[model samples]
Target: MNTIAHSTPVAIASARTPSFSPWRCYWLEAKHELLRLLRTPSFVLPTLLFPPLFYVLFGVVLAGGRSGGDMGRYLLATYGVFGIMGAALFGFGVSVAVERERGFLTLKRALPMPPGAYLLAKMAMAMVFAAIISLILAVIAVSLAKVSLQPAQWALLFAINVLGVLPFCALGLCIGAWVSGSAAPAVVNILYLPMAFLSGLWLPLQILPAIFAKIAPVWPAYHLGQVALKVVDRDGGGSLALHLAVLGVVTVAFFVLARARLSRSQ
Candidate 1:
């Protein structure tokens, strides 16, 4: 009786002892994902450099006196969208396929960490890359391109670019779910490059044929481009509400498709 009484509180305390918080695990998992991406030169270099580099070439040097600030501001917004798309698509699309094949994804799923942690980490990494690209582009636009905007415009553009990552991540997830490890790169390029051009990231749609302009709205990048352009008040013509709705639909659809695909593969 004495021993039982003495041990009761200890037993109760042990029973009530908490396990490691899943949120901490989630944070660590997210940090690891970000670090892993940072360590990969192939991933880091192109994503970080391409936007600012292209902006310097096209948005500044070649664009001097083209339309005064119009071209620079346009390129600023478009290239900002382009950069985020690249980061999210490559970060999730290529990484997911490769990881899925290598069994790392499977292993992670089997671990005690929350299943959502893997996805959260990937999305966080994408956002981090987006933020980096935005900062770099803003610096170059102000210092080198002489592109000026109200602070509010800059803030709005940054917000658009950061949130713009979500739809592409979903699209990338779908692509990752569909492709093999080796084919992921080819598939992503097929989707990324042509869409960018078709959606007028490379040139104004009005400058292209009417046909190209007609097709532009079909691409998710087009909607994001419109939103980005609208921030600069250079959007050609489209209800902001419509562009946002299309993007919302695209995001939800791709995510659903990706979820189904991943669920089946497992």
Candidate 2:
């Protein structure tokens, strides 16, 4: 009986030892999230289709035999940034809200999952989608739009564009945590359209009103667009360092807010 009692304690101690590694949990969650995203057409289709369609409509059709010097190249770069932004916002924001509403996030939290693992997995998934969208847009731009970019230029723009979405993904997380599922899509659209338009994703900043032009630098989309333009050699008198700094600040701020909100909810 003493031996049995002692063995029970040992077994309990062993069981209490952490059953889940944070990284493993994150990876498993990320994989599942990716699969979930793939299976959901409402999520996957928009991320894949919207950017390319936007590019085709604006970059190719609207530009319409009016080669505005480097304008075509500029449009290509902007649309790529636009696509990345869409991926980050829709993928992380709407989905996170849906998960929270559906009780999926709650279920995961009840498990041995690390607090940050779910968010990390989500951010990784956003980056993956951004990269794939960037590639698809790049291919379409080169082949159909007659956009010509050297390999190095393509690589540089792709890398920076993907990195640029990090802030948006973080911002989306905060939005997801704060907003309700029913309101998320509308909230996202309200944020998305303004950011895209104000930041010159739909059109160049020079064409925008002076007020919007002044505030553009304050937005991550503006910085991301600047980064893309720089890579594509289309940024006219834009400061790379300034844009990068603003994006960095915004990312930090959003992350803090998201962490706080998420912690409080728990």
Highest-scoring model, lDDT: 1
Give the alpha carbon lDDT tens digit for every residue of 98-175 in model 1: 998898878998899888999999999999999999999999888877888999999999999999999999999998
Clashes of 2: 0
RMSD of each: 2.8, 4.3
Estimate the TM-score for candidate 1: 0.93
Tens-digit per-residue lDDT, 131-217, candidate 2: 888888887777767888889998888888778789999889888988888898999989998888898888888877889888887
- Looking at candidate 2, the ten consecutive residues that score lowest on lDDT are 63-72
Candidate 2, residue 87: the lDDT equals 79
Which regions in candidate 1 have their CA more than 4 angstroms from the true location? Answer: 1-18
Q: List the candidates' TM-scores in order.
A: 0.93, 0.87
